[model samples]
Structure formats: C-alpha cells, structure tokens
Target: DVKVTQSSRYLVKRTGEKVFLECVQDMDHENMFWYRQDPGLGLRLIYFSYDVKMKEKGDIPEGYSVSREKKERFSLILESASTNQTSMYLCASSLQGHEAFFGQGTRLTVV
Candidate 1:
C-alpha cells in the first residue's frame, strides 16, 4: 500500500519563528510536493522535488523552502512565520503520471 506521513498534524508558532515540517513516503515515488490550503484560495503549491537535491518552486514559495536530501523524505521550511501564513499544509507523492497519495495535513497557527 502507498503510504505518506506528515511529521505533525498540528503546529503553533509565534511570529518570526522558523518552522520545519517533514514528510515521508514509502512508495518510492519520483515526485513529492508541498502545498498550503487556505479558506478561499484553495490549495496552492509551495514547492516540489522531482528528484533528490532538485527542487522547483511552485505557485507560492515566497516564505517557504524545501529540501529532499533522500528519496523517501521531503522537508518544508518556513523561514519566518507570520499570521498570514497560518493554514493547512499538505504533503503528497506520486510516480510520474500516476495518482498522488497525500498525507494528513498539518494545521499551522501563527500567533
């Protein structure tokens, strides 16, 4: 079975704090992605890696960065948390042209 896991299901941070969110996939997928879901804006991509050490900025990457040092793991970094950055973060993985599997999202609240 395809499995994706997020490091946390809930997070709370103060403004200006740096936050790290981690994800792992056991399915050996070639693509991993990070996205944030907001009330009105829907899910917006943050970053994606198609291979280890290679990353592509997605629709929204202003306050975030990503790392994929190993094939089964991906990490998302929030440089400086802000109230506006509060949202649900999701991690996903998929083989090329295949259906993606998603992790249970992390709900972040920046105070």
Candidate 2:
C-alpha cells in the first residue's frame, strides 16, 4: 500500500516558536508535498519537493519551508508559529500526479 505517515496527530504550540513536522512515505515517490487545510479553504500548498535535496515553494509558503534530504522522508518547518497558522497539516506523495496518498494529518493549534 502506498502510504504517507505524519509525525503527529495533534500539536499545540505558543506563538513565536519554531516547529518541525515530519513525514515519511514507503513508495519512493519522487514528489512529496506539504499542505495546510482549513474549513472552507480547501488545501493550500506550502511546499513540495520533486527529489532529494531539491525543493520548491508552493502557493502558501510565506512562513513555511521544507526539507528532503532523503527520498522517503520530508520535513516541514514553521519558523515562527502563530495562532493564524493553526490548521490541519497534510503530507502527500505522488508519482506524476496520479493518485496521491495523504497522511492522517496533524492538527496544529498555535496559541
């Protein structure tokens, strides 16, 4: 089964602290993505990596960044967590956009 697993199911943090979220996939997919979802806002891409050591800033990558030093793992970093950044973070992997699998999601509440 193609699966993506997130490091956390829930995270609570105060404003102005750095946060790290990890993700792993067993499919060896070349494309991995990080997205934040909110009610009625749909999924907004934060960052994506096409291959190891290569990354791209997605639509909503203002306060977020990513790392992909290993093919099966990707990490998302929030430089300064804020209440406005609270949302469900989802990790996804796909090969050429054909049927992407998502992690369970991490619900982050920045207070």
Candidate 3:
C-alpha cells in the first residue's frame, strides 16, 4: 500500500525563525506538492515538484520554498516564519491523472 508520512504532526516557531517541513512517500509518485490550510482559505499551494530538482511555484510561494532531491522525499522550507504563516501544512503525492495521497498534516504555529 502507498503511504505518505510527515516528519512532524505539530510544530511551533517564533517570528523570523526558519522552519523545515518534510514529507515522504513510499510510492514513487512523479508529482509532489506542498499546501497550507487556513481557517477559510482552504488549501493553498506553496510549491509543486514533478521531477528531481525541478519545482514550480504555486499560488502562495512567498516566504516559502521546496526541495525534491530524491524521488521519495519532498520538503517545504519557510524562509522566515511569521504569525501570518501559522497554518496546517499538507503534503501530497500523485502520478498524473491519478489520485493523490496526502500526509497526516503538520500544524505549524508561528508566534
């Protein structure tokens, strides 16, 4: 069975600090994405990577970045944390036209 796992289920950081959120997939999916979920905003894309070292900026890329050094690992990076960045971050993996598998989600709090 395919599975997506997140490094942390909950995280807390202070303003101006750097944060790293990690996700891994057991199935080798070609597409990996990073999204942030807020109260009303729903899931907003932060980054999408299709191949190793290849990335595309999503809807809300500001203050965030991503890395896909390997096929199974995708990482979300917060350049500098801020209060406004507090949200639940999700990671997903899929093959084109296939159903995406999501991680449990990482709830991040920026103070």
Each model's total of backbone clashes: 0, 0, 0
Mark the 10 consecutive residues where model 1 has the least summed lDDT. 35-44
Task: Estimate, for each residue in 12-98, the C-alpha lDDT of model 2 and write its tens digit.
Answer: 999999999999999989999999999999999999999999999899999888889999999999999988999999999999768
Query: Which pairs clash in the backbone of model 2?
Result: none
Evaluate model 3: give its lDDT: 0.95
Candidate 2: misplaced stretches above 4 Å?
none
lDDT string, candidate 1, 1-111, tens digits: 779999999999999999999999999999999999998988899999999999999998999999999999999999999999999999999999999999999999999
lDDT values for all models: 0.96, 0.95, 0.95
Name the runs in model 1 displaced over 4 angstroms.
none
Error of 3 at 28 (Å): 0.7
Residue 11 displacement (Å), model 1:
0.5
Q: With candidate 2 superimposed using the best TM-score fit, by how many Å does residue 77's alpha carbon deviate from the native?
A: 0.1
Where's the lowest-lDDT run of ten residues in candidate 3? 37-46
